[model samples]
Target: MFDVKTIGIIHTPYQQKFGVPRQPNLVPLGTGELHLIAPFNHPDCVRGLEQFSHLWLLFMFNHTAHQGWQNMVRPPRLGGNEKMGIFATRSTFRPNPIGLSAVELHDIVIQDNCTILKLGSVDLVDKTPIIDIKPYLPYSDSYPLAKASYASEKPAIMLTILFSELADQQLLLKPQLKDLIQQVIAQDPRPAYKKKSLSTQEFGITLQNANIRFKVEDDIATILSVE
Candidate 1:
């Protein structure tokens, strides 16, 4: 049997799974921090990692615990109608529910006897357990000619997001985060089945400590409130 230990915990604005982008860098303004656990918090462990501009985070699907695996799984990008081999897609329900994300490295901070990694455009949810970290090597990682079987191109932005007076007032406390919230909503995070529905249902996403409520109607998403 192989043994893997969680080296740290990743903290992100995504307190829930509802609005998180499926892939890294998709939400350009989303930022995160990795807090190294006890023994691994030693500065010597991550020595020289700052030289790289990006890092690959290997983390476990802690939220999917106790879920059984399936040989075939549906991908959201396929409109949730088609089933593909589990290996072909990055589904959360795998034999080993481990996920990998590449994020831009911002800086490293050692404070209060803990080592923290500042990262940008992180896709992992808050409190995700990180198993390992590796520097991203562009020379070997980028494959311009490589074929992406189904996700050939990035998902298109489908909605125009507008903020209400109440939302604006709440956003005044952290105006810099407006772009991140807009980017997350523009991707239309609603489930595939709910995409074209005209129910005008208001959805809420927790960003940082604020609860943002918005509704989509006729392709326009308006922020109704933020608290």
Candidate 2:
């Protein structure tokens, strides 16, 4: 068996899994910082990394690793009705619990003696343990014509987001996060089962320190509060 060591910890606006985008770059405003640990926190470790536009993050699903995995699992993209092989879907409940994401590299900062990577379009939750980081070589990594059976295209924007007067007032305190909050809510972060049922349920997602509360009615989602 091979042993893996955590090289860094990622800090992001997503404090929990409920609101994180299923795929990276889905929410362009989403940002994060990867702080390298002890031995690997030196500037020499990330030298010449600034030339690349993106990086691939190999991280662990620490939150759900304890639950273990199964051979067959339901994917949220399929509306949670069909069963697919665990390997075929990007489900967090994996045998190894490792996940890969391609994130846009914004900047690399060396402060005090630690190395930190500023990232954009990140889909990871806060305090995610990073196993490894590799430069994303576009020449070989991207395939514009690649075929993804079920997820061939980007998921459509499911809801129209509108902020209430109170929510608007609260947002002024953190104006920079407005676009990020809007894009996240527009994805309709509801469970597959909830999408199928007709009920007035208010949902809340924690981004940073604020709790964004909203309700979805028909194709529109109204932001009730941001506290």
Best by TM-score: 2
Candidate 2 on 1-227: residue-level lDDT in tens?
Answer: 89899999999999999989999888988889999998999889999999999999999999899999999998988999999999999999999999999999999999898899999888899999999999999899999999898899899998899999999998887887878889998988898888887766689999877888998888688999988
Q: Give the whole-model CA lDDT for all candidates, comma-separated.
A: 0.90, 0.91
Residue ranges of candidate 1 with Cα displaced over 4 Å: none
Q: Which residues of candidate 2, in runs, are more than 4 Å off?
A: none
On the 0 to 100 scale, the lDDT of residue 155 in model 2 is 97
In model 2, residue pairs whose N, Cα or C atoms come closer than 3 Å (at least 3 residues apart or on different chains), thus clashing, are: none
TM-score of each: 0.95, 0.97
For model 1, state the Cα shift of residue 75 in Å: 1.2
> With candidate 2 superimposed using the best TM-score fit, by how many Å does residue 98's alpha carbon deviate from the native?
0.3
RMSD of each: 1.4, 1.1
